[model samples]
Target: MYKYDEIDQTLVDERVAQFRGQVTRRLSGALSEDEFKPLRLQNGLYLQLHAYMLRVAVPYGVLSSRQLRGLSQIACKYDRGRGHFTTRQNIQFNWIKLEEAADALADLAKVQMHAIQTSGNTIRNTTTDQFAGAAHDEIEDPRLWCEIIRQWSTFHPEFSFLPRKFKIAVTGSPNDRAAVRVHDIGLRMHKNAAGEVGFEVIVGGGLGRTPFIGKTIRDFLPKQDLLSYLEAILRVYNEFGRRDNLYKARIKILVHEIGIETMREKVEAEWLTSRDGALKLPQAAIDQIAAHFAPPAFEALPGGIAREYAEAFRTDFEFGLWARRNTAKHKQPGYSIVTVSLKKEGAAPGDASAEQMAAVADIADRYSFGEVRVTHEQNLVLPHVRQADLPAVYAALKAYDLATPNVGLVSDIIACPGLDYCALANARSIPVAQQIALRFRNWERAHDIGELKIKISGCINACGHHHVGHIGILGVDKNGEEFYQLTLGGSADENAALGDILGPALNATDAVDAIDTLVETYLRIRQAGERFLDTYRRTGLAPFKEAVYAAA
Candidate 1:
């Protein structure tokens, strides 16, 4: 919802031009792969297993209908008729010509989009809760702050080339839908006793080969000093942070090695000097950004227990399932946030077909006032849908294969495009994810199984957030065949915790069965009303592991 001003447009144009030159140099052999790898990576171009993959950033997963339509065009023209939305709230064209990346970036700029900072060891996309503005219990729309951070960090002079990439997540919701606690910098909005709004800043959380839950650096930071405070923290990391080894280079490592208390001391020392500097935010600027996210003049919709709504659920079992899964609480009394799950049966997760994209845009236009959000969970959000029109919306989505009701269920998996598309990947991820989804196709079974986040990344980079999945699966290639190693009890939520590995790797073909075994075993063993994570936390891995491996 943040509109690009002339300055923003100029920045995009200039970056595109810069990348054009860089790409030209690479193509002309003036810049070898050694020189061009970082340059191309910075521009969001990667040479994968088969072809070039171009990742375009959709900041905080927000997109206009026009932008979505443009992406559909890009998918149809440059890619294989679909673009894969990433866990970082970005879209990737798995098949792209190396020569056309600059042109592709230009096309993106036309719609006020770009791929800058999507990759490389700089700050990546700042993600927020999908239902930011429309969520019922938000302190404020977090995307406003996300946009402010975007402007402040974009191509920053000092922090541009860091030891490792950084990620920041914010959520206005108290429930922590954005998984802020697992980010490099996690910001949760809250109000003090005096009713003045502020942020709870947490730092050092990340998921990779090493995963950590961020520790609270500040109990409460006034909204006005957000940028300056953030600057102080970044300055501490930039100046004193480790850079000797890439693996030990993130701020999380710094926080762990230096100890949270010492790190806090260093950050406070820096903040004392930088608090009133130019980075200190202006009240007018914050208000200006907030204006863009103003809620629509939503008239009170009929909240009665309408027979039509009830009948739709009662008669159509599929509609019932979808409504149960795809809808979230809305700020307005009778409105709901309708999540359009991109992960349907047997297809790629987060990869929406052109037709599906258009249909979603149509739904946004007709029912939700032409605003749709691409969520980090690889789904689309019609942020404000009337409770009465749920049936009609469900009917419309049913036609496009977007009506899958497996949100937060086993089938709603997050997976990266692996060896199938990515050269860096050691094992194929999409097919394995599809197999797991197909295996758990039974609606009753998945619902009974309850919430599970199964993320699969092909390699150790953890692009799919495999480190954070309730049942994290990491694919590895042993010799020529693929195998998967599983990690359990991981969660990305209000109680964020990285999973621990259960045991040895499973054969590639047996991976889905392995996942199915784990879920079924949990169902049989869990206490009443306990979810997968809760059971894992309570009972530990021995029972599930015994049940799973005992059969073998």
Candidate 2:
């Protein structure tokens, strides 16, 4: 919850005015579609299959009640009565008109939010763990560094347009909730052997047409040299990254072409020149940035289980299940992190209706210190909820249909807006996701099957993060017919790995059955207390692939 300063407000307002004029000229035929493409993209507007789509950035996935209300208003007034939360922890309006794009951005600026850098080839939103400040296991609040990088990267002259789009993620926890390993650059904060805080810098990690688990370039970098090191990495990529082919233009491909050892040498050479330059952060500045992310006022209470929470769990079986699945331990006594699931049965994943947004905003204000967080898994988090308020929060969410208990289960899927909205997509991902969700609607059965991640992408672009799911589903068009390809053992956690292809692509109609077969195979072969991923890792792909293809 960093409040915008005067400089931040002024820059956003100016950008809105500039884009408004640009939009006017484009509508008046002063600029053609080809000429206007970059301008619109710079403002986070895309021409999709049906209409214009506008993406709004939620920095580090953090939002205040006021910002959530602003998004709800935009969804109610300008576009449809809903908005789609993305895998990158941003929100998208799929039915925006070209004329209203600037107006939407203007409204966003009023709430200290903007759509800038949500798209295009510049540094996109700098994301981090949604539970950054509240998580008990964190070494430091990663959002402090995320905000520093956000200001440094915005409109930087040298990196405004690179070889391809870049993404950066930071994690303060050892558990890696932010999916740091799959980003263009991943920063993990930890203490060194001497007990001094520093970063483990990983670069060249990404997933698209090609997937890679980023290699660590710097084992331990001093905290003060973050910007200098990042500048060096970007400089190397800007100069040497491929630009001729869009498919091979990402920094991941560049790192692949040159070995990690050579890439590290080049970055180290570049870093020597910029280490003490203007980008080198002073301790005072770091302290100033850290002040903005200080912990909220918390009351001291008993650390053990609360009486009300225990009673609710005993009385209500459904609430007990949801509490166990969707809540995480909070660092402060009597507080918990409550995940509000958007993956209700038969609905589009990560989508929230206008009314639901308003309801969530209200709940956040009343029970979670007026703050909400969007997770990379397409869920919302009330990071500071009191244990005593659990029942009330659950009841309110139930009224809004936001209390699904499937946080990491099979039905809690991740999907992109496929052919339904995206022009680049060849097949419809939403329908495929919906079919699978419906097939797994039995909550008890899904819970019994244990933790599983099912991610679906409309194409190879991997917007859905299909490559990192425990069960990855990619939609492909073969000879004008839609087919679905499956991959297994992919994970985006502390043990990050790319899923291997299970077998040949199966027809769209048979995709759900194939998933069932895979799940059944896992259940039969899994050892005691082993999760889907653990079983897959132990048993390998032979069992799951054999079952899926046999059913096919």
Candidate 3:
């Protein structure tokens, strides 16, 4: 909810104009595809399987109703009549034309949105907890710092171009909703002993061809030094991160090669020279940016909201399960975080049709103070909904085919648009994801299955974040055919750990059964009421792994 200032608008406008000119030159053949590739990529434009895909950044995943409506317009006007919300809290239009890319960007700028940091080797969209200002356990609103970081990193002259892409995730809550531990630079905010707010900074975490849980370089950095500390880290990465080998060029590899001790020392030395310089965070500036995230003037609702919500749930078992999963604890007494599931039985994961988009807008207008968020989980969030309104919201959403009620269940699959759509994909992911969802369509059965994060990716690029799922399914090529590989025991919590491969790959037809075997084995062996992840940790993947590969 960081309001744009004149400076912010001007910067966005300039970037759009610059990219527009670049697109013009590229289309005119003055700049060849080879030459224009990097430039266009820097602006978040990519030529996909069918057409150009334009990724539009939704900073910190926050979107006003107006902005969401704008995105709906872009999808209808420039590309397909729909858009794909990505795990990074942004949306990708998969059918944009090369010539229409600039116009798409221009339209985005009109709504205080752009694809500025949606790609390229720079600090990408600063994601935070989807329930940033509303989460009960949060120390402070993290989006304030995210917005500050966005401003600092936008076209930062010294760090604009780097050996590899840089990603930063911030979390104010103890819960790791943004998967901070799996980012290039992760910031966790907490109150220090002296009642001062500071960050526990981690570096080197990322998910792709090589997944790494970033190591903590500094346990606690004072808030005022946020920008300086980040600048120093980027400087060390820019100078020492691998450049010769693209495969090993990520900061994680650099951290791994140099050792955490050496990386920490280097970052500290860089910080010693850079802290309090131009990048140092000022109290006034921080306060000014922080002001935009001030909590909405929430009216006092009746305390019976919880009772009313439960009554509806009691009457509806499916709605009851959804309330338990999709809704999160809100900071206020009666408010709740409502996740609008895009994964209906047959729709592609993370997709919102033009009509569904407008439905979300309408829901936001009626219940959520005209604000919504695109979570890294690829679901729309009404973060500050009143508990009393849960039934009505659920009803409205159900009418729009947005009410899946399988938030943390196995059917809530995360997948990238793979071979069927993306040019870079090696295999199909969406169909596989759909198959899994269909396999779990029995709400009662899915509800019994319990909490699990199933992430899928078409190829190693990991656009779908397959590396972080409790049950990770990665699509790969086998003799010009598709094969699905499974990984179990991954998590993105405070104790964030990447999942491990469970063994050999399975053909597309065999995958759903394989997953069912794993889940059934988990249910059989797991302690009473234990979650899938918890059971996996306590008993190890041996049980599920053995069962999955047993008679195959």
lDDT of each: 0.88, 0.94, 0.88
Report the Cα lDDT for candidate 2: 0.94
TM-score of each: 0.97, 0.99, 0.97
Q: Residue 36 in model 1: shift from native, Å?
A: 2.5
Models, CA RMSD each = 1.5, 0.7, 1.4
Model 1 residue 233 CA deviation (Å) reads: 1.1
Model 2, span 286-358: residue lDDT tens: 9999999888888888888888899999999999989999999999999999999999999999999999999
Cα lDDT for residue 500, candidate 2? 92
TM-score (C-alpha, index-matched) for candidate 1:
0.97
TM-score ranking from best candidate downward: 2, 3, 1
Per-residue lDDT tens digits of candidate 3, residues 228-283?
99988999999988889999999999998999999999999989998979877778
Q: Which of the predicted structures, 2 or 3, would earn the higher lDDT when compared with the native?
A: 2
**Number of the predicted model whose lDDT against the real structure is largest:** 2
**Model 2 backbone overlap count:** 0
Each prediction's total of clashing residue pairs, residues at least 3 apart in sequence or on different chains, is 1, 0, 1
